[model samples]
Target: MGERILIAFNRTRERTVAAKTRVADTPASRAVGLLGRDGLGPEEGLWIVPCAMIHTVGMRFPIDVLFLDREGRVRRVISDLKPWRLSPWVWAAHSVLELAGGTLRGSVQAGDRIEFDG
Candidate 1:
């Protein structure tokens, strides 16, 4: 809840994936990710490091999930995942990026590189 970091997806020709992304690097932060929140904005996202699978057990809205490797390259992408849905386990993923529903519908794709900007 402090300062947010900017994120960009290199493979997308339309727009940036997320303009303000919050890093959930800690266990506590990762565990409480996006739960009980109203909704995710178009330009907001959550980056969960060291994560491969996630369950939207108590989520209020749908979201787009991207599984990425250690180098910030996307390995898999799930768009418009409804609440209570469970994501498939991506063995090659070193992290997970959660964003607003339909965020990656026609924008992002697998193998795209992601970067954090100041």
Candidate 2:
């Protein structure tokens, strides 16, 4: 496990997306991301650094994904991604945020700025 942080949506006027986000910056942690998890709480999330794409091969539930640039600006948004699916590669993305399904429906989007804080 890495540092725990908070994810805030800047475009939404500092609205928080995930208040308890885990950092998956290690190879081991990134490889095991959400594989055995049944589901995520509304305010929980995983932040995988240096990842432009991801798969939900062993995930049991759906999730919402945010592809962000180095500065934490969202480059793309994949909503309600189901298990066993592969997300398209985002060339400009420097990290990915995986949240509970439907979490970003009306909250975040491409071009939205995000902030990570401990």
Candidate 3:
């Protein structure tokens, strides 16, 4: 796991989506994201910085992805992204949040704002 942080969704009444989000800011951490992990906990997530795309080539489970811009505004959301799949490049995104599958169904969406707290 990386540095733990809290993720809050501002648009949804300041709801806390992820309370144990990890930061993957380094090259090594980003490349090895979620690999070898069985699955993510209910409130667990990974935040990859300076990323525009992601893949689950050898992953064992599905996830929900949030593409965020520099100001922490969500540009796109991909839900239930299964293993062995690749995500489309988000040109305006500056980071990405990978959460457990079904986590974003009604709690988050595109155009939302995200807040990170250490």
Candidate 4:
């Protein structure tokens, strides 16, 4: 398991703990997103509660990235991410999460809150 990190963005209700300490995924707590070389969609979204890293050590397909706040709200959502792409520098990000291709499959949206265990 990756190191957990706690974070709360903007007008969130509380703080969240990330399972993975992906520092490069987040630059701050406002601008949270992913680095997409391909195209990401709702099918490849992740449901990370507090924080986590979607590490692609040896995987295929693109993934959509989502940035969640404390209120379980989505701060930012980027889609169609291929491979070998670096996430942009976000200034206001509470936490970061990653998922496999077509994994989300129309499950999450804006103003949605999720739970995670650290």
Candidate 5:
């Protein structure tokens, strides 16, 4: 597990969807990202900083991925990516958000601003 935090997506019309998030900022933490976990919970997520790509080779299930820019704005979204898939490199991405499959398909979108809470 990583450092617990709170994340909220500011969607259109001031709608925000919040979730319990974790930060994977260390090399060790980023290397071991969700590799050994059974699955992510409904509101649980992992945030990897300074990452532009990801792989699910060692994962047990599918996941939703969000590529965020420096200001926490969404740059791209990969929904329900199954295990063993490779994500495309996002040059503008400053971080990556990992969550349970189907978690953000209908709630989050590209260009949405995300806010972090302690």
Candidate 6:
């Protein structure tokens, strides 16, 4: 699931949601920290980008959303996204990755290559 699953888009590339896709960028995509929205935890996360907004209702915790670029490089990561709040401008980003809060563990930073389950 890491080959085609880890597909890349041009942003200029037009795509439909039925594609079961994942994005990699910041400033373009937005994510909601649905930690516990549906019994979420530090290992499980729900990411949404090109989505216009992230959903946060009845959530129980916070999560981090990592934005990436075409080369799978980290652009920036927003951590502890509180429930019921919207993220900043993420349109300039190419894709966004969501992980459980505190999942970064010092490994995440700008210019680092990201790996997706794709």
| Candidate that beats the other on lDDT, 5 or 6, i.e. the better one | 5
Model 4, residue 70: C-alpha shift (Å): 3.6
What TM-score, computed on C-alpha atoms, does each candidate reach? 0.90, 0.93, 0.92, 0.45, 0.89, 0.54
Candidate 5 wrong stretches, greater than 4 Å: 11-18
lDDT per residue as tens, model 2, 38-72? 99999999999889999999889999999999999
**Per-residue alpha-carbon lDDT of candidate 5 for residues 16-91, written as tens digits (9 for 90 to 100):** 4547787888998899999999999888889898899999998999999989999989899999999999999999
- Candidate 6 residues 13-115, lDDT tens each? 2321112233323343333333334544444444344332344455666666666665556677777776666666655556566656676555466656654
lDDT of 3 by residue, 1-118 (tens): 5465766555545788888898889998899999999999988999999899999999999999999999989999999999999999999999999999998787787888898886
Give lDDT for model 2.
0.89
True-structure lDDT of candidate 3: 0.89
Better of 2 and 4 by lDDT: 2
Please count the clashing residue pairs in each candidate, in the order shown: 0, 0, 0, 14, 0, 12
**What residue pairs are clashing in model 3?**
none
Model 4 segments beyond 4 Å from truth?
1-60
Candidate 6 vs. true structure, TM-score: 0.54
* Cα deviation of 43, candidate 5, in Å: 0.3
Candidate 5 positional error at 12, Å:
4.9
Model 2 is weakest, by summed lDDT over 10 consecutive residues, at: 1-10
Q: What tens digits encode model 1's per-residue C-alpha lDDT throughout 1-118?
A: 5745767555445457888888888888899999999898988999998899999999999999989998888899998889998999999999999999987776777878887675
**C-alpha local distance difference test of each model:** 0.86, 0.89, 0.89, 0.46, 0.85, 0.49
**Residue 22, model 4: Cα distance from true site in angstroms:** 11
Alpha carbon lDDT of residue 106, candidate 3? 70
Best by lDDT: 3
Once model 4 is optimally superposed onto the true structure by TM-score, how far is the C-alpha of residue 24 displaced, in angstroms? 11
